[model samples]
Target: MKNALIIALGIITGAIVIGGQSFYHLLTSQNIVNVASGEVRLGEVYDEQLTTTVTIIGDDNETPILTITDATDQIVKDVKQELAQMVVDANKTLSAHEKMRLETAYFDTNVNIELSTEVEYHSQYQKDMQLTIDETELSHHASEQYHFAEAVDMLNTYASKMDTIYHQNDSFIHKT
Candidate 1:
């Protein structure tokens, strides 16, 4: 009986030790898994933030430029149609030179209005881009700042071209 009791006690003690070790291992492995999962979540969050920022900047830079370009194209088409109609309706008795002068005057007066409006819109776009660049400069990310700078430079170049067109048109109008 005494031998049986000793055997039972040994078995119980061994089971306790094994169970305790297993519990300890489980806790440590679970902690490691949790830490790894947390890091992965953090990485996902960081990527999401970068993607969102880039998308916002792209939209802000591209949308207005496209809108203005489309508007300018439409205005040009309308002006051409109007000028062609005017030429068609011009008095048949006028000399070709006189007719040309009259057409030039009409185009200068009417087209200038459209050009001026476009220039004004482009100028406002430039200002808005400058503001976006200024705001982006406050961010810690260098990539974002670089992108904004590039966008601003492109806007400046486009604005300069528009200005040149307006000036050329103005000079021609004055000469006529």
Candidate 2:
């Protein structure tokens, strides 16, 4: 009976593993194909925090400034979504460890709007868009420094290559 039970457990585990891999493959294969074919554009992902200023009309009321700020926030949100998708697609080819590292990583952007009286009536407000990513913690441990360094290099190389590929061709194969 014990031997039979052990065999059953092994069979179940095997089935689960196979099923999980199949599901993962199904989910990731299309993204891999899309990215490889350049159907997905990853050049829009900013490497670091980006700050831009958009001017608004100077007026005593703050609604216009808020509106501009909200729009800028939406733009940042869109960029973030693009970046996340790029990461997901790129990670499909990475090892389990590398994918885990990237999955744990975080990126954030903030938009700040300020009224500028110095500007003329047509452009009286300025909005600042900031994007930020923190990697210090990932490399803080002495034992893990090398791993983090490699991960950073890998990610940078992938991003640069993808960005170039995205801009240069509409349907080029992913060389990386």
Candidate 3:
């Protein structure tokens, strides 16, 4: 009975040590992003045995703070990719003439509207965030529920414009 008890205790301790090591490994990986104030994101990749975190810094209670977590890198990367593609698609939607016009007026207007929508939603919805861009600080004001995800959705709508432009561009040919 004494030997059995010792064996069980050893097994349990070993298991705990292994589990702790696994968790530590996940946390140390740069994939984790922790925020100071707003919503922090975390992801558990069971197959890869990885945990990722992303931190969004924004204003909360009129000051900056940090919210720590393991899940934001993917989201921001995703947003950047989507938005960049959106910019391309938006440009693609114009005929040479229309595209020429957009270069001056419509492009800037649309970008402003989309940026306003995204910034407002992303800033307000996240409580206690340190809002900064390119390391520059941002001030905060109360706004109703401006969902960032929704704003991204709105931005993505611009992609449809690409199809419109393509149809009109005589330079484009569908080889297939």
In terms of lDDT, the best-performing candidate is 2
lDDT of 2 by residue, 1-176 (tens): 99999999999999999999988866544321133334432222222221212222122334432221122223334333444565687679989877734345433222222311111111112122221111111212233323322433443443344344433432223346
Better lDDT candidate (2, 3): 2
Give the range of the ten consecutive residues with the poorest summed lDDT in model 1.
43-52
TM-score of 2: 0.23
Q: Which portions of model 3 show Cα errors greater than 4 Å?
A: 28-37, 42-132, 135-176
Q: Candidate 1, clashing residue pairs? A: none
In Å, residue 35's CA in model 3 sits off its true spot by 6.0
Minimal lDDT window, size 10, model 2: 115-124
Give the deviation of candidate 2 from the true structure as CA RMSD.
Answer: 24.2
| Tens-digit lDDT string for candidate 3 (1-176) | 99999999999999999999998876643222233564343233122111122223343333312222222223334554544554566568877765422123222211112121111111112332232211212222224333334434543443333223323431112346
Residues 27-141 of candidate 1 have per-residue lDDT tens digits of 5432111222241111111110000011112222334111122232243343344445545666466787676432343221101011122222112112211001001111123
lDDT of 2 at 164: 46
Which structure is stronger by lDDT: 1 or 3? 3
TM-score winner between 1 and 2, please give it: 2
Clashes of 1: 0
For model 1 the TM-score comes to 0.21
